[model samples]
Target: WHWPTAWCHMFLAPLFAATGLLLRLLLRLLLDLHALFFLPHREAEGFKEQGNAFYIKKDYEEAFNYYTKAIDMCPKNASYYGNRAATLMMLYRYREALEDAQQSVRLDNSFMKGHLREGKCHLSLGNAMAARRCFQKVLELEPDNGQAQQELKNAEAILEYERMAEIGFEKRDFRMVSFPFLRCVMRPLTAASFRQISAPLSGFLLSSPRSDILRMDSTNADALYVRGLCLYYEDCIDKAVQFFVQALRMAPDHDKARLACRNAKALKAKKEEGNKAFKEGSYEAAYELYSEALTIDPNNIKTNAKLYCNRATVGSKLKKLDQAIEDCSKAIKLDETYIKAYLRRAQCYMDTEQYEEAVRDYEKVYQTEKTKEHKHLLKNAQLELKKSKRKDYYKVLGVDKNATEEEIKKAYRKRALLHHPDRHSSATPEVQKEEEKKFKEVGEAFSVLSDPKKKSRYDSGQDLEDDGMNMGDFDANNIFKAFFGGPGGFSFEASGPGNFFFQFG
Candidate 1:
């Protein structure tokens, strides 16, 4: 059956093509089977389990190694990459963590934790905008995720803060003049007009508008003065002083620049002395130095604000709480966006038992920073405020929230003796009545706080008035007798409310 040459050639080509296709398919099957047998899924899973164990133990380095091994065995596994990303994040390797987190999300787009890790990496790297997007993606994946919600809020706050900071800077700088004429004419004229009319000029081509003017006309005294003002406001003291000096050199008769330069130098020196004294625990010296700095540069709002804040800190150390609060307020007035001043004022408020003011300041701080510590402080202030609205057992007894049972007992014993009605017998009727009221309050406080269930209920914000814990029903005299075995057991010498001496029989 010999066919024609052309037909035979056609048949052989088809047969060869089919055979090659079958061979390739068979080779791929063999490779897959080899992978299944040699690269055991169980082994990879074991490595992942080991990684998890190390992670639980907080041994991030060991966990990273095991996760890497697991990834090597199962390159397509999103979970392995996610786990490694978490380990890297614990090590503060945000860039590496970001890469792994991205890879994990690429492998499994639906992986919520992968997106969460990616968001956290973005946040740690200070890319709040990117972090916001990642957190939004996580919310899309898992709508009820609490961590994602909080992180999204944090990212939004940071972005808002940064936006406000930029606006503030623009407002302070003359470069952002919005008038069409000034925007178009004054800006270009300041930078390029001198260059065009005068000889070719050259200096450091800096990134600021004033710096541009300086680059064209380095000897321009007014531009130098303005540049120095920018640095001075930015809190770059030494650089600002240098620019001011340069301006004075360019025009010795420039009184404004001369005054600024002198004030900058004096302020810097005084601020340094204040800081040194503060670090050495000399609160009075620090206060004096900071005050001097404030006086040296009353016109320098930014620097004066910082000096006020520094003095506030010294005042706090000296237990001059009112002065500290006033100083913080002055700082806040000078720079409304001053976070440190707000925080300092909040602490002073807490120290002075102004719980409501403290809560407000802490809330502001939390809104800006949104850190765990800030949240904690805000919560504590709120709790104190709540307690203040009711009978503040801790405040009445002069005890802390974490006071031990023995400490509570000691505080109760001391308070009972001080507020005892008999102790104020020689005082006026108004004083006696006030002492009586305080005595009753002390008894009610002890009644609630001495009982574990009552204390817990009070601390958790439960209404104790409905829980058979009425102050009217509480007997101050009976409680005092029970605690101190009556006046016969303990003799007290008292001239007034604060002066009491007890001698136990």
Candidate 2:
């Protein structure tokens, strides 16, 4: 029994030894395989070395990718961030580059290359004040840095010129709005005139400091944005938008310029829409669009006045005469020399039979407008006012301008019966009041026409102007409707005594 136990023990010990060696070899092979699949070939420094190689070759895009990997691996490494920022600048990704440059400086404040890259990034972003500080810091760390000194000088020059341009824009641009009278006077001028007007700035354009900054450093976002504002004010909209977009591309943080760009685009689109609707004779739609334009750009006085005048024209077409007159008056008040407003209001007054008021408005137009059509309109208004002042007693009585005394009497009696207030007593109170006023008008006309001398004076256009009518107090539209035959036609001549229901109040 002891010998057999010794044999089993010896075989078991050998078997266990062989199994342990095989297991050890298997474990070692698995560890090597795992490392091959999952472990990196190098650390952040190695990745940055590759990035540097690409950067030296000027393959910025490839360099940026490698540097991004280095940053992901060792976020605390200032040199990694600094190198990546340099690559991003080469790629024209200034905003992204600026962030990296700032972080690189923050991680290791004494890293001179980080500070140098940070200064360049700030300069590119148009932060001249910040760039100056960074370059000053670089000089503190390394006193005789020629590159930093040159950049500092450039930043100072840019800052100074930007200050001067802003001052000029503020002082000179305001004069454009203050003189509304000059807007119409300048409208006939071509783009060449605008260029000539901006010729004062033309020197600025030829040696544009802002433009110079952009040319030297395409990522000067603030300088680019300021130039966009100047161009926008000059009415160079497309060029303005281009500059604004480039500014935003370089610096996403430029909120003020972004908002201005959006509003300018919206205003331009809405004006075009308004013009299209007006041309299509969709006056109602056009009016709403013009109203939107005014609301969007109320500060542009010349544009707002033109919008008001156009809306007034639509109001006239829509039969909103009073509102049209009100709008036209506002437009004329804004630009007193606006001949179109005067013409529009004059025509409205003529339609309402306020010939004296029409004459005044027409006279204003004639003073500004030398067109033959306006001159003829002025003549008509003057003639109508002369005829209106005499109170056309014969026309008021619905008798022929040459009717005999007996016929005038008969016509008066007929009109009196037709317009008696009692006949309208069952109608609305407003109608009844109008009927009473009209009855008085008829009675006054009858009294004058029956008197031979007064009648002759009224006919000869020399009657008393005060006692008969103040045209505004009457509903001339209703009177015209009634005097015309069947709501369709009427002669300029006073018709024979008809069943006239002259509206008055």
The TM-scores, one per candidate, come to: 0.49, 0.38
lDDT of 2 by residue, 1-505 (tens): 7999999898998999999999999999998986764344356668888889999999988898899898887778898889998898776556688889989989999988888887777766557688889999999999999998887776676555445545565565322321221221123222222232333343454354455435654676756665565566555667778888898998888885687688668767887898899899998998899889867644334455677888888888888888888888877865677788888889888878888888898877777777899889988888778877655666768888778878977887677666666456557899888887777778778766777876666655663555564434555334434533445443222234432334332
lDDT score for residue 154 of model 1: 71
Error of 2 at 478 (Å): 30
lDDT measured at residue 132 in model 1 versus the true structure, 0 to 100? 97
- For lDDT, the strongest prediction is 1
Q: Which tens-of-lDDT digit does each residue in 1-505 have in candidate 1? A: 4567778888888999999999999999998997896667778899999999999999999999999999988899999999999999877556789999999999999999999999888876667789899999999989999999988987776565455444534455323211221112122121112122111111111344465455555897866776676566556889989888999999999887887788788889989999999999988888898887876745466777888998999899899999999999989976789999999999999999999999999999989999999999999999878877876788899999999988988999888877888788888999999999998888888888888999899988878887766668767878877788765677767656667677777
Q: 470, model 2: CA deviation in Å?
A: 23
Clash count for each candidate, listed in order shown: 0, 0
- RMSD to truth, every model: 25.0, 26.3
The local distance difference test score of each candidate is: 0.79, 0.70
lDDT of model 1 at position 105: 98
Model 1: C-alpha RMSD to truth? 25.0
Please report the TM-score between candidate 2 and the true structure: 0.38
